[model samples]
Each structure stands twice: as structure tokens, then as C-alpha cells.
Target: MADIDLDNMTLDELKKLQKSVNKAVDGYQDKQRKEALAAADAAAREKGFTLSELTGGQVKKTKAVSPPKYRHPENPEQTWTGRGRQPDWMKDALENGQSKEEFLIV
Candidate 1:
């Protein structure tokens, strides 16, 4: 990635670089798919079909997503929620080396 110093490259060079790499390709594909799905949903709504109705009884139930727990980068302290009162145990754990990824997985 160090070879990709964009600031030093010419427009022609930049175009060449982009062509050779994915360059946010995954995000772009996801965005396009989302847009297409949104358009389909809107069309269905206009046709007086409820979102559930259009799914032909194949809708998947989804729960509200809970926020990820936060832990200190270098410590073991873990926080189930990043909001509200901070706990002393969490602070101590964070100081000990329990990272955010470890907290999330646990």
C-alpha cells in the first residue's frame, strides 16, 4: 500500500492505479445492491403492497441491533455499553489488557 502515495501521482497515474485495485469496490457493490433493494421496496409500496406482503411470507425477522461493547485498547477493562456510568472494574480491566475485540467476543 506504501506504493500508493496518491498525492504524488498524476491524474493518468491515478486512473491506472484505480483500474488495477479494488479501491472501495466492496462498499460500492454493497451500496448499489442497497439502492436496488430500496427501489424495489418503494415500487412495492406504491403498488399498495405492504413490505411483509411483497415478501410472499419469506421475510426474515430481525431484532434491533445492540451496540458493541467497548474495551480499552491496551487494558482488560470491558464496557457492555459505552454510555451511562463508567464502572471501576471496567477501568481496571482496561488497564490490565482486555481489549474491545475481546470484550465484544466474550
Candidate 2:
């Protein structure tokens, strides 16, 4: 690595250098992770097992989305899935004696 005279560099020059350094570091880290994973996969295959199987083949879990069960009377775009706490609009309407059944999407 070459010596950098950081104090002499202008702000723009420092920013450009910083960006270049960040890109280089990220690329190096990604390459290292890929190489490590490849080595682990090869080792697992040699032991007559796949990497996924040894790792339990687990995948990232995503929250299940409930379909919208209620919609605003005037604004068709505004909707609620009827799972969590009611929206302010719903609360206000209910306070004004509007029934929840009136807001049902069906």
C-alpha cells in the first residue's frame, strides 16, 4: 500500500478516495465470504452431505400478511387487515356510533 498524505488532500479528493477505499473494502469482504462458503460446501460434500442439509436448510422467515378485511367508506385505498390495533379513523368512527360491520370489505 502506498503512503497517503491525508492532510494535503482537498475535501473533494478525500471524499473520492474514501469512496474508492469503501468500494475496495466491500469487494474484498464479499470475495472472502464467497471463498469461505465455497470451502465449507466442498468440505461438506466430501463428508457425503450437502451444506444446506448440515445447516438444517433453514430459510429466512417472513411475516404472514393477512388480507384486508375492512376499508374506509370514502377512500377505497385506505384499508385494514383487522389484525392489530384499529386505526385513528376507525376509532373516531366507532366513537361516533358507526358499527365495525359497516366497514367490512365484503
Best TM-score among the predictions, by candidate number: 2
lDDT of 1 at 106: 47
For model 2, residues 33-64, the per-residue Cα lDDT tens digits are: 88988898899999999888888986233588
Q: Estimate the overall C-alpha local distance difference test score of candidate 2.
A: 0.91
The 0-to-1 C-alpha lDDT of every candidate, in the order given, reads: 0.70, 0.91
Off by over 4 Å in 2: 59-106
Candidate 1 RMSD computed on C-alpha atoms after optimal superposition onto the true structure: 10.0
What are the runs in model 1 whose C-alpha is more than 4 Å off? 1-20, 59-63, 67-78, 81-106
Clashing pairs in 1: 75-94, 75-97, 75-98, 76-93, 76-94, 76-97, 76-98, 77-93, 77-94
Over 6-97, each residue of candidate 1 has an lDDT whose tens digit, in order, gives 89989999898787666578779879978877787788899998666988967555677666476544564544576677677666667888
